[model samples]
Target: MKNALLIATACLLGLLSTTGASLPYPILPPLFVNGAPDSLTHFLGLPPKLLFALALMVNPIGLLLGTAVLGSLSDRYGRRPLLLVTAVGAAIGHVLTAWALASRSYPLFLVARFGTGLLEGHSAIVRAMLADRLQGPLRNHALSWLNGALHLGWLVGPLLAGFTIAWGLTIPFYIAAGALLLGAALVGFALERKPRAAGPSWWSVARERHAFNLLRHDGLRALFGVQLAYTCGVTAFYEFYPLWLVEVGHYDTRAIALVNVGMCGLMTCSALFAGRASRTEPMRRAAWLAACVALAIGSLGVGHLWVGLVGIMAFGLPHAFYNAVVQAWAADRFGGGHGQGAVMGLLSTTFCLANILMAAAGAVLTLVDTRLVLLTGAILTAWAANRMRAWGSGAMAGLPPAA
Candidate 1:
């Protein structure tokens, strides 16, 4: 029961943070491409696509940096303190984002987004807490719930923005900001810190044992290298699919939100089933799932209405399963002795880096056509699938050697 409560809290935090962070997905592009020109969208006379890409890139860059250290910090200082501190900072970031939007200050909005992403390392922190408590299938199940919560947040954030942007562009941001504070309160009151001996300062620990340290291992290096490519595919789809709708189907904010509901809703359901089949090797399953997801995502660039609908919705199944399989595999194989916070942080850092790479590349590709970006994602994921299968036989046979 206690474990259940903690997992629930972690899921809720994932929901809150992701929802707030993804608010701009359906809203921002239209603001740049279709809405009245403004200081934010037209900064320094750059094209709207470039400006929008910069906005998207800044946050993930911060996330990449923050995860590098925050996970190690939690391992030294305790999860509760790190969670509480970061939540408040992220909430403030939302408020700043709202203010920037209201004032048409693009520079400030970018700064706020970066700050929010930097402090939003709480996802890794919460996952680390679960890793500390649960093992094997229980931990895998809990991570699935957390994964579902994040997908649901992606659905809700755009849904909320789609509905409330009519009232004001900044309204959804304010609502998300308030929700973040509530999440912070929940953390402060509902969760208890596990007692641990404080060994060294967080900075010292962070400096020595950062997120990328795991990459020093040959097996883990190949694992994360595969993950980097896989995540690039995922981020490209997540960040640009709405834009794809806008360009191909002439989708408005409301229409884009409704479409996301279909896809992200499926993802939420699929997450429940993640890693449930114990007989299948996780790496093998992950390879199959990635191949399926690549096909689904690749099909969407064709622009047929039926193809778009089915492709968007069906891709969720394999994406969710793939995420769960990889995370659990990483935990079971590499999480011993090394802090789970650090391991989880490595995953988070890799994801943020993937996001940054895709966003930047997608911007340049979007200038020609969004289909090119989608195709690039599909190709990378297919390559990753093949690579993962190659490594599966050896990795499935044995546990990771010590760091």
Candidate 2:
């Protein structure tokens, strides 16, 4: 019963948090490019495209720091308290974002997004919680549940934002804020209060025990490199496609949301399926999946919008399979010794770093051509696939020397 409750709460929190986080996705591109000029969108005479990149980059910057620190904090301090506080704090961040949108203040928007991203890392906390209580296959299953919930939220968030945006531009953020507060309340109710182990001072913990601490382990070094390269590809695809839609596909907010609906809906289904499916040769599977994603995305370079949309929608299944198998491999290999929180946090850190790198590079690339971003994603993922194939063959030629 306790396990059931925890999983349920985890799913709920995943849904709410992802929905809140994704609310601005369908909104931001149009707001920057096509929405009526305002102080926020037209800030300091910078091009809207550059400002949009800044908008996308800031939150993930905070997420990088927060995911690194917050996960380790839960390891020492306890999960329930930190999770609840961060949920509430993220809710506050959403309110500030809504205000920034209303007042047309780009600086305030950036600050609010950074703060929100910093506080909104409780999803990682919940993953650590799952890893803490569950072991072996059960842990993998629980992660699938969370993955499904998150992808469903991805679908729901854009739909809600797209459909209701005409009501008011800020309504989606307000709704997101409300949903987060409700998630906080649910976290307080469903999660049990666990006694924290006695540990060093909080500041000391923050200083010493970050997600990067896991890098000392030699076995994970290659894994880290592969994941980072792959995530660079993934993040590039994620951050740029909407811009692709805006500039090349000639899509507006609602159409982009609808397109995301197809992608995310399929992703939600695929993640659940991948979680339960048995598979062999995990590394090979990851390689194949990455290759498929690369091939599909490579079609974008064909310069036909409809062809690219087919590739985009086709992306979800293989990507979900890759995520499920790779994450399970990490937990199975590394979870027993290293703390799950630290392990998961490091994975998350890689993701954030990828987002940062891709977004910054994309800002420059968008200035050149949006297709350049998509092509870069294809190239990186293909390279990662080759590396993973080599890793599986024990060549380990170019990777961290297996040390």
Candidate 3:
């Protein structure tokens, strides 16, 4: 019962992290168009384009910092305390962001976002916590559910942001802030504590041979590369997709929000399915991953909104399967005390670096046709598939055949 509670609480907190971060974003286009020259231009001391780029860049960097630091701290101190800290801090950040938005304070908004990122460590932290407590099927299942919560938040947040911002652009932040408080309460009361020794510090972990050694392992390296590629691809879509819909497809904000709902909805459904599927077969893992890469690549090549929706559905469906399979495989490969924390941190760093590059690239590509960006993603996905195949074949050679 206690273990179940911890997992449930973790899932809730995970949902809070993603949904809260995304709330301000779905409304960003409307906000940018309507409020930007008035609210952000002079405050940011950069062109609107440059400010948007900076904002996008900072979000993932903050997440990267949060996961790297907090995941490690959770390893050292235990999940409960940091969970508490993050929840409370996130609540504060959200409320402050709402006020900042009302005041049209860009610097304050950036500060709020940075703080939110620091407190937003719930996803990575909970993932490590589950790794500590569960194994095999249960662990994979938990991760899937965790991802589902993220997608669920994704599904609802944009639409909510769209509608709520009608009242005030800053209003969505208050709603998001309320969710964080509720999440904090859920976590504080339900989560059980299990403290362990502090693992290596970030620099110490970086210096360690095994930490570096994990990257050298052919299979893990391929998995890590795939992770990087997919992250870049996803960030590309997230950063540019709505803009493409507006500019090329001529869709309004409501239309774009609806499309986002479809994509996030499919992703949420896929996570639930993948959670169940991961325990049964590992090669199923590779197949789902391949499917994800293909769909994500294909989505960009299509132009019409209906056709594009089909591609978007394809793009989202295999995400959690690929994620669970890859992470499960990594956990199985690197099983030890604090090894999960280290692996997660490295993965977080890689994805963040990918996000930064993709955002920069996406910003540039928006000046061109977004379709070309998708083709570049497709090529990388193909490269990742070949690498995963080689890595899988080599790594599986010694192990018993999949059941």
Candidate 4:
């Protein structure tokens, strides 16, 4: 029963975190458009595209810093306390975001987003909590379910945002804030704090030096490399897909939301399936590679609306598989040892770094040609697939069996 409660808490928190994070995607484009009644350009005296890109960039920067600091804190202080604190911070951030939007303050909006990112750095903490409680196949399965919950939030968030955005731009923000607070309540009430053996100082374990050690392990290095490349591809694709739909496919916000729903729905299903199938490590790796290939093909072929939709679906389905498998792999590799929070924090930082780089590249490329972003994504994904294939040949020799 206790284990079940922990799993439930992880899933709920995952859903809340993802939903709040995704709410802005569908709503921001309209607000960022030049001459739109609610546009930020008049207030900020910056081009809409530049402002949009900066807005996207700031969150990840905050997340990078927050994950590093807060993740380590969780390792030292305790996951439960950190979870409670961050969840409250996230709620406050969202409230501030809503106020910023309501008052039409661009700078305040950016600050709020940064705060949200800082607080939402609970991913590593949550993963650590699960890793601490569950083991072996059960742990893998729980991670998969956690991944699914995230996608489920993504599937629902944009649709809700799109529909409610008509009521008021601030409405979605308020709703998200409320939901986050509710999640905080759930965590505080439901997740029991487990005592942990004292470990190394967070500062000692949280250093960049430790991240280098992950590369010393042959299997871990390959896995990390694959994940980095894959993240670059995914960040480019997801960040710019809305722009692509608007500019190239002529999709309105509602249409984009619908498409996102479909894609996220597929991704959620794929994550659940991958989680169940993860017992077969070889098969999971193969599926991951295949998914990358599909991402490349679909991304490269997205010229028209129908083709873009198909490409989106193709990429989205396998995207979850890659995430689920990689997360399970990471947990299996590092969860048993001391400083699991720090290691997971480092992993989260790597992904965020990739996101920051790819998102910046995509934003710049969007000015010249949106298709360039997709094409670049395709190439990167294909490279990741190739790397995975090579890594699979002998990488498993030193690695433990997948939990």
Global lDDT scores for all candidate models: 0.86, 0.84, 0.68, 0.73
Q: Residue pairs in steric clash, candidate 1?
A: none
Model 2 C-alpha lDDT per residue in residues 72-130, reported as the tens digit of each score: 88888988998899899989999999999988999999999999989877767888888
Alpha-carbon lDDT of model 2: 0.84
The TM-score between candidate 1 and the true structure equals 0.95
- Indicate the worst ten consecutive residues by lDDT in candidate 3: 204-213
Q: For residues 1-403, what per-residue lDDT tens digits would candidate 3 score against the true structure? A: 3668767887888777888767755565545533436656444355554566566666676776776566665656667787888888888888888877778788887888878876775576777777778887888788778788877787677787877777877777788888888887777677755655656664653345222345666555555667677677666666666655665576656677788788888888888877664344564456457656656666666766667667766767766567767666666665463467666665666666666787677556645666766666666666566545554555445333323
| Candidate 2 ranges beyond 4 A from true positions | 277-279, 397-403
RMSD of each: 2.3, 1.9, 3.6, 3.2
lDDT of 1 by residue, 1-403 (tens): 3987899899999999789878889998788888777788898889998888888899899899889889888888888889999998999998999999999999999999999999987788988888888977789999988999988998999999999999998899899888999999999887886777858766778789888888887777777888899889888888888888887888899998998888889999989888474677677778898999889889878978678778888988889888888888788777786789999999999999999999999889999988888889888999889877767655433434222
Runs in model 3 deviating more than 4 A are: 33-36, 39-47, 193-219, 277-284, 395-403
Model 2 misses residue 318 by how many Å?
0.8
The 10 consecutive residues of candidate 4 with the worst lDDT sum are: 394-403
240-303, model 4: which lDDT tens digit per residue?
7777777766666677799889888888888787765534555247546555644644554457
Which scores greater on TM-score, model 1 or model 4?
1
Pick by lDDT: 2 or 4, better one? 2
Q: What is the lDDT of residue 296 in candidate 2?
A: 78
The segments of candidate 1 whose C-alpha lies over 4 angstroms from its true place after superposition are: 194-196, 395-403
